[model samples]
Target: MNEDKNRIVSHGAFVVRYRAAGAYRFEAHSHPYLTVTSVMSGMLEAEIGSSHLVAAPEESLFTNSFQSHSGNGSDLEFVSVGITAEAVAEAAINAGFTKAGADIAFNNSYSSDRSVAEIARAIAAEVLSEEPGRNAMLDALISQLVIVLLRSHLRVKRSPLIELSRAGPVDRRLRRAMEFMHDNYSRDLGIEEIAQAAYLSEYHFARLFRRVTGVTPHAYLANLRLEQARELLINTGESISDIAGAVGYQSQSHFTKAFKAVTGLTPKSYREGTTRAVEPAEAGKAGLESSNKVSSGE
Candidate 1:
């Protein structure tokens, strides 16, 4: 089995990423957001907490905040939509869910909702295209998915007030570290430096940081740089090498490899909005397949 090649497209309220067809397995981990993965092809076998589930083409799988999930997929290609808990809460309120302040969770780990499948495919299309109004279109599509889940798939867990009030000194220090990273992401930084910003020893900072954010400091910083690089790719006409330097990558080759590894497209290709991995025609066929499955009661 090989590692999956991932392509990410970040939006305001949600992030959509595509995992290329391959055999891959991931260790048990958790996220602070709601993830809805729509299988475009092949099958996904996953374990979310205590439940074991399989999602097939035109079906979707859900993982709510901090719910431990691990999975393996064989020849699997999918688009995963990650919506923050905050976004879900907002949608829940809009959908008339009374317990919006409580923790939001999914009632089912797997979904065969036709509407969700449709919207997921639409989002994939938008991601693969450079169509005008792409941002607006994605916002609308993601909103529909959230609304559908709120109406049919959500459950609320009443949480203790104390849990919400855990923003103690240590948490404040973590926030400081995060702010430091954000402010200095364009420069080469080190773990010791970041740890110093949090006013903790490197060992302590690393441990608490992962415990809080679910990723190592280095991984977080890499993601931060890539995010900034992505914005530069989309919004500006900066040359690739200059953007690479601005994002703290010392060399163009290193920056290109990192960008392509995460995005499945070279920086040049992404900036051009011409992804050769999934063509427009192929994406359209996927949309049709999802629609046909709905009509045939699959």
Candidate 2:
């Protein structure tokens, strides 16, 4: 959305996202790249396949490429590094798993390695500063994360012997309802309309949806909207008022209140914290200035 090239830092083979604080949920989804999320504070509740995981501070979670996983955070600060599959393969080869590159995966979703946690924080620091060599620092950090995973946690990819199922008409209805919520989260959505999408009455829909998701439809939609707003704040130069409207909130004040309640930071503060970066020429100039100071022995 934000066409400003400065807002985005290009890491050649990885994508990095950071959240300073928030309650957020990602509905069931899969990606072609592997993801490692390190939680620096609070907790992350997630579901990977049939496994439910809770990662607290100093813990990291791994999701292999194409693994269907979903997670929600509770007042957390985290950095998630998304590594391209090709990068993983190359890393695996360099780790002496040359024949196993195609088979590399994580059998488990949870890790408590301190190196992973520290590297995650380093990546976050690099993201927030305009320090010289920021891009190079990020690339090296990403490579460190990958190396840690390959050395300490790599597993062979394999097919499950049996499939787990939640199959039934009710499950189908609930999924349809979730799909509707996801598709139209940018607009004001109501219970009645959402119920119709699931082919259920409003009363039953409210009850069943909560039972299935452990959260009400309204809560789910709000989380989805706030997550979108968070991304806009981090990656775009849009005003807070504009972001509120884009995420379906009619009032800027209301959006600010809700955002602070969940994230522990105002929208403006969050944006300011996440978008700091130095242009190459400016960084070079700053380095030169520092060198001049050192030469003068001041």
Candidate 3:
């Protein structure tokens, strides 16, 4: 097996475990691998890009690769199932799934109370168990999990590509601009360069892009950079200055200021917060609250 495959706890394309003590905080980060998270026990507040999601016990969150996000848990134990984007796309094509054109952004709420939760629990248990044919078992479980999630997505009439296409002409153009920004975010991206990618005049593109995405192209790019920096901070022991440079910020102070503005917490504080545990009382309360959130939404 390849080293990347070996790194996985499962036989499928992507899967791993993150077990941390107390309330865990993750700085903004993006992964090349798609991720599906299941909260075994605990409460977590996650920000996927600019949107916020609250995860309770048995709930799941699916994020596409390179989707900027961050999370923090107070008194919780969780397991995240990582699937490669290539694997998901291949599976969809093989299954002949069509785009549904709805934005199926990940919700903190459970998709289905009985069935989806049951499947999540079963997969979690099997993954944690040491038994015969564990690899095969994991592969089967991942397949089942993907099916359940696809069903949930279909029920909501949401397909990623379809949703992207539905963003209207202006939004589509903005998405293209975002693509360009992502590709060259570490380098100096002139407004004219981004505008050309979307086939619009710089003034027109700048106005429309902000109208659609709620931030100037520069601000949006900065947000993406900070998100990348946050990920390195949490996942690696890289020094702050190195991370700053990697994400295109020459001044550590500038990066720190932007990171705090977007995340509401300084990077150092966020990292330290991850080391503290969530109080038992608060965990119980969050569990109850999440249950209510799911049922009420239905």
Q: Count the backbone clashes (under 3 Å) in each candidate.
A: 0, 0, 4
Clashes of 3: 4
> lDDT tens digits, residues 1-298, model 1?
3244555665434667777656656655555468898998888898887789999989999986545677877888788888866667666766677553465778989889988888898987876566655655666788888888888888855543212222211234486787788789889899999999889999999998877655678877787787678767765679999999999999999999887665545788666532322323333343211111000000
TM-score: which is higher, 1 or 2?
Answer: 1
RMSD of each: 9.0, 11.5, 12.3
- For model 2, how does the per-residue alpha-carbon lDDT over 1-298 read when each residue is reduced to its tens digit? 1111112242335666666544566666444457888887888898976789999998998987546677787676777777766677667767776543145667678999999899988987876565777766776787888888887887744322212112111245476776777678878899999999889999999998776554577876786687667667766779999999999999999999888765445687666635334444434442111111000000
Candidate 3 residue 93 C-alpha distance from true site, Å = 1.9
**What is the TM-score ranking, best to worst?**
1, 3, 2
Name the best candidate (by TM-score): 1
Better of 2 and 3 by TM-score: 3
Those runs of model 1 whose alpha carbons end farther than 4 Å from true positions after fitting are 1-10, 15-35, 44-55, 61-77, 84-86, 92-115, 122-138, 150-173, 274-298
List candidate 2 stretches off by more than 4 Å: 1-12, 156-298
User: Ten residues in a row with the worst lDDT in model 3?
Assistant: 289-298
Error of 3 at 25 (Å): 3.9
Compute the lDDT for candidate 2: 0.67
